[model samples]
Target: MARGPYEAAIPAKIADVDPQIDSRTQSLVEAATVEMVRFDAELGRDSAPFAALLLRSESASSSEIENLTAGARKVLLAQLGDRSSVNASLIASNVSAMQAAIGLSEDLSVENIGTMHHALLVSTDQGIAGEYRDRQVWIRGNSPHSAEFVPPHHGRVMDAMKDLVAFMRRDDIPALTQAALAHAQFETIHPFADGNGRTGRAIVSALLRAKNVTERVTIPVSSGLLTNTRLYFEALGAYREGNVAPIVELFAESAILAVDHGRLLAADIESALRDYRERLGATQESVRKILELLPREPAITAEMAADSTGVSTATAYRAVQRLEEVGILSPAGKIRGVRVWVAADIIAALDDFAARAGRRSRH
Candidate 1:
């Protein structure tokens, strides 16, 4: 049934790539880049708080690309330190890794890539958390002979990764194109034993940050890929065949769709914020402070809110009580023993975004 294990994989040198993006694909990349800039500017315009909602969106959608599914409530609970659902915890770890990528964006080196991988898998699979594989790795089958892809040998992993990092640091390439090629090349390299897909996607996020395509908000490009993974995979396959345009075009299309969907999610968040404003007509500073924090910290405790808002525990609890009375916040069970309050509307909006992102068809 199966044949030979195949010849040793030839590692491609990709440090200096000149992608041949066609006219249509080039236009699409231009349009997508402009839309991404516009979309980021629309939502709070460089505020760190807004990044939370979309970062969660991006991470969850990215995880869903690998079939790691979790409802938004579970993910929010996990973000608030719940960690009950295995999938939710994993998705949350993906979120953490994304944050790590963004944090390490300024550096963008081989070591930081390992650090991002470590952040992603340390909690779930500590043994191989940040370490590159020392053995051959193949994809999609029981043995290398039947595998869909056999990456370069472990000995070549670091060297190829170094080349990729070098490519990532270049300024001649367009941000979207660079990110696209970098992602496909990293996937081609397949440096790590596990979590390659997620880690590779996270590096895209980092590249966007490093290139300054997005400063405070994530584009959720993976959500766009989530819509039609067949095409996405086909594009990756084409990349391996030395066709760079397909992946670049896919990233462009995904960016535009992600921007459109992100706008809808932003509308939902804006509406929730408006509802909070109406319900919080004559609140005190502490109540106002906690309310401001709700978009970023959907599931918050009184103590946590107090510490964040620089108020006493009693003041924070009173604020939570006021928000709860106004129907903006509600109890979401306890974390350890303290009752955690959640912004139900915010979580609902994010869940709706995730649902739409995961929905089939792209129009």
Candidate 2:
């Protein structure tokens, strides 16, 4: 098969297209969106930190969809500013994009999408982090002629993204359905050269947040998509072929799975928190504050703990020592020259969640 010199795919404008979905799909999407809203509400006002854990879980699962795998330990290390493991660091960077998505959810503009893309890859590819591709790129093969999918030429990218952002501004569409369509359109745009998949998934997250489908936490739809990756890719292909329902149905299914899986992981993290509370029975105010911060920063130094908890470094170290004594924090060795400690139960809970959310073929 000849490779290269083929015309790029010019995706249709979706800004005003009111695509219809079947009754079954509409029902599925409605149910999933409700469950997602319920789950986020149920997590409640106090469980906000669990939001970080769930976001990291989604980031890890999303990274796996791109074949970037890393153990929980190394990822925790990377989160602590250690860059020894490149994949772990990359996966760690994904959390930033997810965060940027939710933070910028109120205004889903092309500039903010680029901001999310920048947050995703700035650490790894500063050159292309926030900028749209200036050249044509293809998927899967050495050249465009042999590629599985070819996105639009660089000349069309800005306009394509503008249309996508315009489509996102519409409130008539259902939440999950809109998110699915936006994601498919983003992938078809392939706006960036390296981090499109991650940013595309982040766009799904941003829509979910903007639509208020999930208010407190990220629902791990990426992990749900991870459960059957071939099907997910096939759904994207179907969307590009003018069949939008498949992708909508996929997001519906993915949302249901995300909520189910997220509930289980939340239970695990909450259980660990209970145990930590039990171990520390009666503790100082600073110690109490540090315990609350553990799930978000399982691996940390006294400095980070102090900064996050608004306690003195000495007080934070004392609290860390107490937690270390009670087995809540164990030595994580060192990042650079500073000693770090980890909350073993929290990391174990995270690892367990990651293991359960790992790849599985759908029947």
Candidate 3:
């Protein structure tokens, strides 16, 4: 049954997950779940802006894991329809994928997984957008013979995926435990040709939302993974060795870290917006509207602001100029003759979030 440099890993036995986790592991999961619940409740119904921020952070970190790096400024610019770097496009695709995953959280299935994958690659590569790979795939090397890990052959991918989907739907295990297992299994399947890692991470976020561990906030788990990239990969390897505890522990710890980091970010943004509003000192309606929109979009163009606020182009320009004068926004240079403005404080907070998350891994 064994194949390539790896042991036989197909037909993932996810249905029969281990029932008894140690008391310590259970305690960790419980504490992490509590933190996640608290984080979600604090965001409440008006969480869209914070959710967008966290998801962007998640997308950037997840893509970085694949060695695709893009800074917050470039990503925020891309969100405003600016022409950004190639890596920004890939990270933007990841953001779309995360959104798709959230939408599909209510029903986790093989077909929905395909839809998420399609959303991820549709903007970049059309050929392998939704379909599972039809040929063999390997990780970290050019060929299966020399790869660090060769997944199951192409013929067995769908069967393995089916098993994983079934497991994802089960409620027997703790949510974190189930998410960890499902992620490991999906990575083992390596269903897609080029986006398995990002997709797998998306599944983790989807599982959290689906299970109500997080209602409106997508805990920045990738930020935690980026914190210890080696440990994350090592946990995946440990899962392959029939030691699921490592990955489960990693997920639990990551959830805790994400909640802590998210709290700091939420505070920073609230303070920044307060400072901006105070500085403006009862601004015009149009300018105030733009301020409301900035949390969800740290970067904007006059056209984007006008479209979002249903105002004239000239009005939008005036509002932008007012905000710029108050130093609430700064011009981030021109993109194709159109001006782009960035909320510098928000971008700085996001960059700091990413830096703190990745700092441990660099040491």
Tens digits of per-residue lDDT for model 3, 1-363: 334454435544776666457889889999999989999899989898899999988888899888888789998776555655888888888999999999999999999999999989998899999999998888876567667888889999888888888888888888998998899889888899999999999999999999988888799898888788889999998887778888888889888988888888898899999999999997789999888888888899999999988889899999999999999899998887889999999999998888877777443
**C-alpha RMSD of each candidate structure in angstroms:** 1.6, 1.3, 2.6
lDDT accuracy of residue 73 in candidate 3: 94
Best by TM-score: 2
lDDT on C-alpha atoms for all candidate structures: 0.89, 0.90, 0.87
Candidate 2, position 293, lDDT: 94
Off by over 4 Å in 3: 1-8, 361-363
TM-score for each prediction? 0.96, 0.97, 0.94
- lDDT score at residue 335, model 2, on the 0-100 scale: 89
Q: Which stretches of candidate 2 lie over 4 Å from their true place?
A: 1-4
Residue 23 lDDT, candidate 2, scale 0-100: 98
Better of 1 and 3 by TM-score: 1
How many angstroms is residue 284 displaced in model 3 relative to the true structure, after the best TM-score fit? 1.5
Error of 2 at 302 (Å): 0.6
